[model samples]
Target: MSELNFIVTLFIAVLGPLLAIGYLKPILLVVLDSLCVEPLPGKIGAHFWVRSACVLAVAGALVLALSFGEFDGSLMQALRRALWLAAAGSFVSIAFITSRVWAPVQRRLNAQLNGGRG
Candidate 1:
């Protein structure tokens, strides 16, 4: 691929999963909330794992679906690419969620440690 094409492809590969996760996360949270599923007390790990699984599943399925037609080359190669993209997307989504969840907590803890000056 030309440099321009490579850059565009890279951009789409990185952004696609983020956009998918961004759109799906709120919907998933709403559905879970409506089901009255409460987070385990003092247990963020379980929530993180569940969310990670969900992100992987959604990203994988989307990649699989789109790969058949959207990607070039042999089936196996396309599948390999799809899986890699899905994994990358899941990691990005998880990192984003982690930062969003922890940033405020970190700030609050800092404030407490510094005698409420933060």
Candidate 2:
């Protein structure tokens, strides 16, 4: 592909997943809250926050390690890849958390909507 096309394609590829993941964050928060409730006792929110932080930290480290390569490309390419990795990590974690949070509610909603009268 042409350089401009490649850049646009990369941007879209990076952003699409990031946006999808971003949208899922609140759902994951709900899930984390629900799961960490009684089983987690008084520190539920803290626990979830810590877990998310840890995930981000790990992702950052991994991205840094993977991105360590030759200095051949333009600075823009490097910056784009860095941003993409950050977005990828954020979105993936959010999606994970939201999906977990959504599972129980999804089941209940499905049941109720299907005429369970719940």
Candidate 3:
């Protein structure tokens, strides 16, 4: 591949997943929320953690499964790459979920810490 093409491919490979995760996270949150029989009590509660864990597990499995078929490297190298991708995906997933779900709680805490300043 030409230099430009390689650069473009690299950019997409890195940013594409991040963008897709950001876009899909809200929908995932909605689906997970709908699975709950009763509305969760607080902004950050047990159900919130459960949903986050579920998302991480699903994302990790997907990363591993997808990476497994793509790598032509040795078994150890492939496993390492897959694990790294899973870790990155889990971090992104958690960051997305926390930023969305904990926004209210964070704002409240900030206001309290700032002595009710806006």
Candidate 4:
């Protein structure tokens, strides 16, 4: 890739997953509250922040891995797979939270739409 293209790609790769995660964070909190789901141990405070940072770093590392092409040794290979693991966790968490959050609204809308039906 050209310099400009690589730069743009790197920026998007780093920002894209983060933007999605940031957008979902608040909604997840609300859903967790409404459902009264208990958070895991050590998931609050600094630990939570560290996990979020890991997600961002994994994304950036993945982008770097792909951009550079080819790796020598098992460590880079492991890091590349870690990117997939982190990305899966991030996106899957969002999906699960969104569904929980959406279910109530969908039920309400369906009730409203069918209100006049026999």
Q: Clashes in each model (backbone N, CA, C under 3 Å)?
A: 0, 3, 0, 0
- In terms of lDDT, model 4 sits at 0.51
lDDT to native, each model: 0.53, 0.53, 0.53, 0.51
Task: Name the better of 3 and 4 by TM-score.
Answer: 3
For model 1, how big is the CA root-mean-square deviation? Answer: 10.9
Question: For residue 97, what is the lDDT in candidate 4?
Answer: 43
RMSD of 3: 11.3
Pick out the ten consecutive residues of candidate 3 with the lowest summed lDDT: 1-10
TM-score of 2: 0.49
| Models ranked on TM-score | 2, 3, 1, 4
List, residue by residue over 1-118, the lDDT tens digit for candidate 3: 1344333333334454545556655655564454434556433344475555555645554654464432455555544554555556656665666676566667667878899564
- lDDT tens digits, residue span 1-118, model 4: 2444344444444554666666656655554344433454333533454345447544554555455523343544444544554465456655554565578768767887899585
What is candidate 2's lDDT per residue for 17-108, written digit by digit as tens? 44554554555456555555565653577356645644554454345425542134665665565556645655565556556556867876
Clashes of 3: 0
C-alpha TM-score for every candidate: 0.42, 0.49, 0.47, 0.41
Kindly give the stretch of ten consecutive residues in candidate 4 with the minimal lDDT sum.
Answer: 41-50
Worst 10 residues of 2 by lDDT: 62-71
Candidate 2 Cα deviation (angstroms), residue 23:
10
The residue-level lDDT of candidate 4 at 42 comes to 30
Q: Clash pairs of candidate 4?
A: none
lDDT winner, 2 or 3: 2
Give lDDT: candidate 4, residue 17. 60
Candidate 1 wrong stretches, greater than 4 Å: 1-72, 116-118
Stronger candidate by lDDT (2 vs 4): 2
Which regions of candidate 2 deviate over 4 angstroms? 1-31, 42-50, 53-61, 64-71, 110-118
